[model samples]
Target: MWHLAKAPDLADMEVMAHEMFALLPEGFRKLCEGLIIRVDDFPTDEVLEELQAETEFDLLGLFQGVGLPFQSGEVSGQMPNMIWLYRRPILDYWAEHDETLGHIVRHVLVHEIGHHFGLSDDDMEAIEAQVTDEAAEMPLGAPARSG
Candidate 1:
């Protein structure tokens, strides 16, 4: 089974992120109405420089744009808030740790979404716990798809 296993690619991670997002509490999901989620192999050079990351693997995921609490009225050309999941780094971390890929993806998703809500680490942890509990209750099968 190990020999047959392959690391998830960008599209796979994107689906995982969306599935994880769907697993989150309904109210929490509602708060993320206009949020966009994307996955890439790694952080871009500009992103690494701007975040002062020592390497592409240094950042697992990122939340870009102003958080809800900081938003004033809409600007003329403001970009929608986005969460970027660095696939390679996330895979690297998964290989080094004992956690499952789904767990790690859920974590990164929650953390970035937390930033969108201007939530603290503690708040995110609570949300993670809720998601974990809810997910465990769900029957094992295909992940929920977003339309």
Candidate 2:
């Protein structure tokens, strides 16, 4: 049977995601509540079926379930909002792109968590711009990288 090589453990991904999140402005993390971050090597066949993916390499991250805005009255127990980062896909992206691994991880984290809060690409861009502006306000000699 064909199988993939070893990947980063779940704990490591969680820690990596959190570290990237912390680097964002304080308010950004607060906006996403009960959003669970999960990491897996590639999307499962079930996910491919659900997402109508034609190939395994088609996805890097996925946000499962609905966002908060759509909820109405009388909501009972339900699954928490979740973002899945496909490890192999991310590693593939890393290899394909010239960006640093930390930046790629941060990009994945931001986009996936961005979905949890119902943020659009434009919205994410604005947030990114704001973070960039804030970082520029730091000490003159020392500069903070966007990663």
Candidate 3:
């Protein structure tokens, strides 16, 4: 069984992210409406440069677009909010950490989404705890995919 295991690919991570998102508190999920979550092997060079990251793996995920507190109804032509998960970096972190893949993905998702909500680290940790409890109560099954 160990030999059969392989690292998750982009699509796999995307699905995991979606499933993790679905497990979040309903109110939290509601706040994330229209937010796009994407997974890539690594962040683009542009993103790395803009963030002043010394290496591609230095950043695990990123949240782009104005936070909720700064949004204005008058502003138009603004890009939709997006959260990017860097697969290679996330996987690398997973390898070095004791956490499960799902746990790592959920943590990164919460962290990035927290940025969108302008939430503090403490708030995000509370949300993560809520999600973990909710997931524990639910029967395990394959979650439906969503865009």
Off by over 4 Å in 1: 133-141, 145-147
- My TM-score estimates for the predictions, one after another, are 0.89, 0.73, 0.89
For model 2, residues 1-147, the per-residue Cα lDDT tens digits are 228634446566555655555567667766666777777878999999998998888888888866667756556777877878877777788789886555666677778768666889987766655544344233223433433
Give the per-residue Cα lDDT of candidate 2 at 52: 99
Overall lDDT per candidate, in order of appearance: 0.83, 0.68, 0.83
Runs of candidate 2 with Cα error greater than 4 angstroms are 1-10, 130-147
Decide which is better by lDDT, 1 or 2.
1
Candidate 3 collision pairs: none
User: In candidate 1, residue 54 scores what lDDT?
Assistant: 98
How would you order the candidates by TM-score, starting with the best? 3, 1, 2
Q: What is the per-residue lDDT of model 1 for residues 54-91, given as tens digits with 9 covering 90 to 100?
A: 99999999999878788888687999889999999999
Relative to the true structure, candidate 1 reaches a TM of: 0.89
- Each prediction's total of clashing residue pairs, residues at least 3 apart in sequence or on different chains, is 0, 0, 0
